[model samples]
Target: MSAAGGGSAGSIRIDRLLVYLRFARTRSAALALIDTHALRRNRKHVLRASEQVRIGDVLTIALGSGVRVVELLALPPRRGSPAEAASHYREVDSDGLDRKGQMTIGASSPAPGILSGDPEDFS
Candidate 1:
């Protein structure tokens, strides 16, 4: 079983969190992203997949040309429905903070480039 918030005050490892949050299709894909050195924690570059993330730590992962910023949230027990997974965290902005949770937080958005107000599962 995967460890849920195992380190430093209920923290989860970056790669595992990605899988749990369904950000990647699998943990290996998550690790691949980390290896690119395109991942950031609180606007700082993340060096490894094993790095731990706390409940409020903001993460930035490069996706295509854009980036996805997600705040670490409570540890999830499983990869539930897309909606269930989304509840685990909110999206952070370039300013390193969420603007009242206005940004989209999901695997896919309804539109091509813009994010919908409410996060939805297109899959």
Candidate 2:
């Protein structure tokens, strides 16, 4: 039995997770995002869309403008409301000051050579 308590296990496909968590608008979009090789799982680059992301996994996603890091809090059963989806993961704001009131290092710039917003680039 997985941590989710059911026999299905507490894991979801990375592509599906992206949509479920409102990160990617659709599965195809998620795949395109994945193709960029900019998404990282637990600090390791995610090379495929079929990879599994379990509860508590940390995901670092490079967006069009910046990178966002999130720690999985739960495995969403489905693509729910934004609020519900937001509940499944906690953002790890590395750019902000830490508890010690010191600057923490984080990816504050967009990924170089990765055209994130141009739909024409993916074609």
Candidate 3:
């Protein structure tokens, strides 16, 4: 789903997407992440930085300390502020772990108030 204010409507290069979403500080960093096989799109290894990713795609990124699984809610037109970039995707607890990476007893829910609206909308 595109953003309310006319966001990009087609697939985006994964490297660019990473920068736009603030996953990486720069495009080169994003490429390095991909080169190291630290990113997976829909559970499959991302072979290149140019791999296309669209709205609703789930990305599992292995960061320095932990993993981050996020679903693209919208493709931002540019790399905006932290809050704006945050609104473009939703963090997902794919492994049923909480903030500390410990297993949870019940369903995993997105962090409250990080973004407005139901995350299930992307599902």
- The count of residue-pair clashes in candidate 1 stands at 0
Q: Candidates 1 and 3: which is better by lDDT?
A: 3
lDDT for 6 in candidate 2 is: 37
Top TM-score: which candidate number?
A: 2
Off by over 4 Å in 1: 1-9, 94-122
Query: Per-residue lDDT for 59 in model 1?
Result: 79
Model 3, residue 92: C-alpha shift (Å): 0.8
lDDT, candidate 2, 1-123, per-residue tens: 554333457777888888777777777878877776758887777788888888878888877767777999998888787778889999888664134632222333333433343445333
Tens digits of per-residue lDDT, candidate 1, 6-44, equal: 556567788888777776667777776676665678766
Candidate 2 vs candidate 3: which has greater TM-score? 2
C-alpha lDDT of residue 48 in model 3: 89
Colliding pairs, model 2: none
For candidate 3, the 10 contiguous residues with the lowest summed lDDT are: 107-116
Tell me the deviation in Å of residue 33 in model 3. 0.2
lDDT of candidate 2 at residue 120, scale 0 to 100:
56
Model 2 worst lDDT window (10 residues): 102-111
